[model samples]
Target: MTWSLIAKDVDGSIGVIVASKFFACGAVVPYVDAETAVATQAFCNPLWGTEGRLRLSVGEASTGVLTDFVRRDRGQAIRQAHMMDKYGEFAAHTGSECIDWAGHLLGVKHSVAGNMLAGPDVIEATSAAYLAGADLPFAARLIGAMQAGEAAGGDKRGRQAAGLVIHRGQPHAWLDLRVDDHADPLNELSRLWDVAQERFVHFANAMPDRARFSGTPTRHQIDEEIAMAEARRKAEGRGSRSHAVEFG
Candidate 1:
């Protein structure tokens, strides 16, 4: 089974996707918010996201359209999926023919999933994490939820890949972090999230002065800033960690 958390940024303008699997599993989820965001997935339905976005662009209410789509899927009995849109509207389906013990759980702006966990407690923990308003990063929040779920009763199959995506302001992605294979995917995802933040900081720093400050920065000023930051980094023993390092 699968669970996904899709949300807009705090201002209600971005889109995010975070999910967990019992193993190599991923969601067959789909979503759309014509005025805000659109996303979808299936065991193989990549076009769900694209088509949903198009529908939103043409002026459709995300919830109404998604509800209609799911209800129309005669194949709804074939997969386990969840979805959320920019408006905070959400939906999920667990096919009758899905693996035994498969199910999904939901909370405000969040959904939790597990296929072979001890019971429904795994998803309950994830929902609780979202509802409790934890202070962790998006990935950490997801993993925290997963961990709580696991503590309650995780997958009988154990862990595998995990993914996190967040988008705010821009109709596209801001965070697309993942751990494709791992003994502990949620933990790896947490490490990758740290690396993603550091990469963003470096990218921000390397921006052309016009991009960073909205005005040309003198080459001298740029050099001085770089030197100062490098000095600080070295002094703090944070040296030589390149952007290429794999946090996962």
Candidate 2:
């Protein structure tokens, strides 16, 4: 019912993941800890969704967390999860009893996992696309990877919910977009990402942070940042549409 991936940026300062599944509200499948840059996914086990993130957020190692998860969960046979820690360690688990086409691919700083998929090609396409988009923006790279997976036959049951989460140097999400239910959730998620770049990102950049707890950029300053973002997008040959944009 799901396909997902977690990855760190080339510089290792940013982490993003995309998850899409056949269930409603499946967009919330990923748990990210920005402070440690740890991203964890728990598809078939609800406990790992919270407990796993808590462990990683509190400085536990990915292997240790995953080990404990497997130890404590009696239903491991149907579970699936993957983790990426701050040190670029990658780990993944796909239960033997999971549906056909269920498996995972772990890379140096990234991991892709899926269950109830069309075929193993889904993971292959996603991994290849992720590496190919190494130079794109972090969030864009994740979306592109998911796009490739969808092209290769995503969830066998079809899309219903999709999500993208990204975090940088702060404990809060730099970008978090979700499609709770949509005919084409991935494209909807991409559209929301573009909308975020138009304003939310500029606003987020000005929010108080560890280095500047009392700092808040003025409206004029935020406007400048927005314009700069738009300029950068245009320079990259991306369209400059303030609204009414569509994602294919």
Candidate 3:
């Protein structure tokens, strides 16, 4: 019912994108932190979102985490998941009982997995788009990759919702957007990404960080930062993450 791409960038950013015929696909399917990324779908066990993340955070290897999850789950044959560690180690599981065309693929720093998809092209195009757009901002790369998957015929049933999450420094999400119900969730997500750069992304930048106990750089300070950041982006033809917004 869903497909997702989980990746960790060289800069220690972790991102996840999920699309599905199911409602609120993002809320349950993808999990990410500054250190690890995971997608759990195909008869998803929600516990993996929390448990798997916790396991990885505590220093468990991706392979070991997958092994532990599989050993404890009785319905492993119907479940699907893939994960990547901060060190770029990857692991995945695709159940035999899952729908046909359900599988996964791994790349330099990413993994693409889905079940109930239209065909192998869905993931193939997704993986290709992601690697091809290595120069894009983290959020752009993820959304564009998923869009390619959609163009290649995404969820076999249809599309209803989508989600993208990125984790950079803090324990909390660096960026998170979800389209719980929408006719074209992917485009809506792209629109939201555009909206985020307007103020939300810069606002998030002002929040308390590793050094500041109480988020400094108050209201007006944030406003100036936003304006200045935009000016800088315009000056250099850059956008998110100091790079131009170029989608594949």
Candidate 4:
């Protein structure tokens, strides 16, 4: 019912993943370790959802956490999950009874897993696109990977919703956006991300962070940062025609 990839950026300061499938996709398939930046996904096992993430948050190793969950769950044969730790340790489980085309691929600092997919090619395309877009912004790279997976024949049943969650040094997500229902969820997600960059990202950058406990930028400063971001966006060939004259 879902396909997802969890990966850490090259510099190790960011981790992100994108997931999509049928209704309520965001609610079911993703989790992040707020403290450690480990990511976890549980498919077909509602009970294992938060527990898996909790384990990772408490410093449990990825493989051991997944192994123990499988061994202890009575419905293990029909459920699946994949995990990646901040240190690059990874593990995945595809229960024996999951639908056809169910499996996972573990790569350096990344892992992809899905069930009810078009074919194994879905996973391959996702992994390839992610690695190929290493130079793109973390959120964009993840969306690119999801788009590639869709092109490779995404969910055999068809798409309905999608989500992208990314975290940097903060305990909360740097970007957490979701399309709970849409005809083209991934594309919608990309659009929303662009809108975020227009002003939200720059405004967020001005907010206080670890090193800047009282560092909120002045309104004039925020406007300057937004202008700089717009210039960068245009230079990168993604400029929008609806550029506003000024921010209120």
**How high is each candidate's TM-score?**
0.69, 0.87, 0.90, 0.87
Candidate 2, residue 35: the lDDT equals 39
Instruction: State candidate 4's TM-score.
Output: 0.87
- 2 versus 4: better TM-score goes to: 4
Best by TM-score: 3
Query: Could you give candidate 4's per-residue lDDT for residues 1-248 as a string of tens digits?
Result: 78888888866544545555677676667676444433334346654657766776667888888889889988888787887754568888998988988889999867888888999999999999999997898888988998999999988888888887776666667777888888899888888888888888876777777778876757998998889988898899986644357768
Instruction: Write down the lDDT of every candidate, Cα atoms only.
Output: 0.54, 0.76, 0.88, 0.77
Q: How far is candidate 2 from the true structure (C-alpha RMSD, Å)?
A: 3.9
Candidate 1: tens digits of C-alpha lDDT, residues 169-246? 343444556666678776676666655444353444344442245533445655666666677767988744444745
Report the number of the highest-lDDT candidate: 3
The model with the greater TM-score, 2 or 3, is: 3
Candidate 2's error at 39, in angstroms? 6.6
Deviation of model 4 at 186, angstroms: 1.0
* Candidate 2 or 1, higher lDDT: 2
Task: List the RMSD of every prediction in angstroms.
Answer: 5.4, 3.9, 5.5, 3.0
Ranking by lDDT: 3, 4, 2, 1
Worst 10 residues of 4 by lDDT: 34-43
For model 1, the stretches where C-alpha displacement exceeds 4 angstroms are 8-44, 56-59, 113-116, 201-248
Mind giving the per-residue lDDT tens digits that candidate 2 earns over 89-180? Answer: 77777877888788999887688988889999999999999999978888888988989999999888777888777777777777778788
